[model samples]
Target: MKKTLSLVAILAAGTSQAAGFQVDTHSARATGAGGAATAWLEDSSSIYYNVANMVGVKKLDITLGDTGILPSITFQRPNMEAEGQRTTLSPPPHLFVVYKPFEKAAFGVGVFTPYGARSRWEEGFSGRFRGYESSLATYYINPSFAYELHPRFRFGAGLDIARATIELTRGLDFVNSEGSVHLGGADWGSGFNIGVQAKLLDNLDMGLHYRSAIDIAFQGQADFQNIPVEFQSRLTDQKAHADVVLPSTVTAGLAYRPLNNLLLAFDASWVDWSTFSELAIRFENPSIDNPLPKRWRAKWKYSLGGEYGVTDALQVRLGFTYDPSPSPNNTLTPDLPDANRFKVSVGAGYQFKPFRADLGYQFVALADKESTAPGMPGTYSGNAHVLGLTLGFNLQ
Candidate 1:
């Protein structure tokens, strides 16, 4: 119970977004294909999707990409007029490099943004007491190795080094007046990822991948403002500590090529979000703890995509995905209002000798949800757009 509360305090605001703030837009190829590239290895960037597929890459390759995510949310109370909308745009970069020094072995490195979120609400809003400004960010660096065990089977493993940071602000009331409290923290953690790829038939490929969870303990200071003079001593800048576990994931996928120039793929993944049940922040001054509740559940996501070679130098891609939210209704807050999402994606790629460039765009439609959580009461609706571009070079 004690550990659970600490975990909740550190991760509740971080993981309350779409599928608990787990961003999957790692590569343009994957993004264009609705993140269904697990079993379809087309470029060196597959190191992050399925490292085992590296056994099929024969040259030194490097890819650089970035994703622009724009999100909007609107809220409405029963009788009051609709509130103004909140919008924010986030851009994260990705890089991957692969080298094959032997016929049966390969090595690769990847730097990607797997999770992040930001939310800001106007002051004096209806839900101001719930939260005002919040943000969470993470970066991962992975070094992986792959080996071909047989003509049709390959295995891979990698170690992940990640750094994360978080900031949260909320309104508080004292003596019939309004005030605010702010908290900030950062940490570094380690984990591992593993994968396997197999050719089930002459034209069918299958893959399985898993990433272990990383645990981070955060230590920082809590700052308060506008508090009455009486409680200033105990509410001012104080030391705080909390901990959270970044959940793991398991993915399975299959790719089939029915023609020489056309390929189709599908993937399904399960995320462990139940680890976050409660969150507690311990303060140094009064030695008191503030615990928040978040009964999140596991979530599943599904994606399908197809690629067609228009000519020797160009390829067209189309994809779709269904992503469900894991946020429990009782814990829903204004700072992280999220719902199920349906996404559509399209992209194209051009290859010129050793250089290739790819571009993709995804549109997300979020379902409207009604929440009657203790302090916050409203209906929330939102949408998102994601744009990605990747440039790669082949150095053989």
Candidate 2:
């Protein structure tokens, strides 16, 4: 029972909590700085970022977007310390649709990868001494509706269905004469999202959206070969039944045209990271230690960003955000090296009448976190770079 509870807390929050953990400035207008404006989602993207903004559309617009994320990590466990890391490539894509079927009613739909990333420590990597590899993938399908009530008033709603899978390999410190085992599992879940956007005034806009929490139950088994005994409690063990929680959040933004061609936007948001404070999974086939410790806590995230139009055909954006690590300093694990961060981003777009294209780039510099946990060890002093592109076509 102690082992099961311990294992659950070790992997829950970092793996399942939905605390806006990603610093994705995917929109050209949102990335230029770091997504400071929530009101700009008026475009087709309102489906993922803000459904209330869906009413900001005047015609039928469809958008296709993609972003590539590359990150590096380091570790300083109670014993040894390693630094400066490089990870493989993970690409995420998005698609959005908005149409004013009638004058007062608008329909929207979008497909995108909301929260995701991949972390792989190559063979011989230092962390391998503890447990060495992890990768996660996830996506969502969003369908929504919006209606314009008055000249500057609009209302909207959204529905989201998400799916995910993962492949991982961790090292097990051995004690006795037992070989270490490799552990892994895959699961899926479903959930819903609701939102509202209203023009607080002519130059100020307000938006709020929430994604209901979900539970993904893993069903796959694992393969264990050369394992270690000391770390066998966590690594060599296999889980037949386990469940993870995906929380929810709310976002708000404003857009103001400070100049004739210059549009300024800023956004503020919050997430429910506390739902993951802990987790305990009871395997259908109970093991010695069935329920483990999924110790995670509530976290908070906020962002500020804006966009400017250089000309009728070109526009630029910039944003910044602060993300707090939900994993406490005491229980920090290698499966997820999460911590607070200060993000900087830049992006631009080109508009051609009914055709528009956007591109954005971001850099994440870690805020110093010198945590010397027991199992995982490392001084994480690295950064991450992200590239995003979006294309939009209006079916007028």
Question: Model 1: per-residue lDDT, tens digit, 296-319?
Answer: 788999999988999999999999
Residue 310, candidate 1: how far off, in angstroms?
Answer: 0.6
The lDDT for every candidate, in the order shown, is 0.79, 0.62
Predicted structure 2: lDDT? 0.62
- Candidate 2: list runs displaced more than 4 Å: 1-26, 77-81, 84-86, 125-130, 176-184, 227-239, 279-285, 288-294, 375-378
Q: Candidate 1, 149: how far from true, in Å? A: 0.9
lDDT tens digits by residue: candidate 2, 1-396: 112222223332232112224434445555665766556666888777777677778779888877777766565544554644445666777888898878888898878766665555555565554345555555677788887778676777777777756555555445454343344566567777777667676676666677676666666455566755444465444555555565566776666766666666666666655655444434434553333233556555677776677887987777776766666666555555666666777888898878988888877776556555664545554566778888888766
Best by TM-score: 1
Over all chains combined, what TM-score does candidate 2 have? 0.86
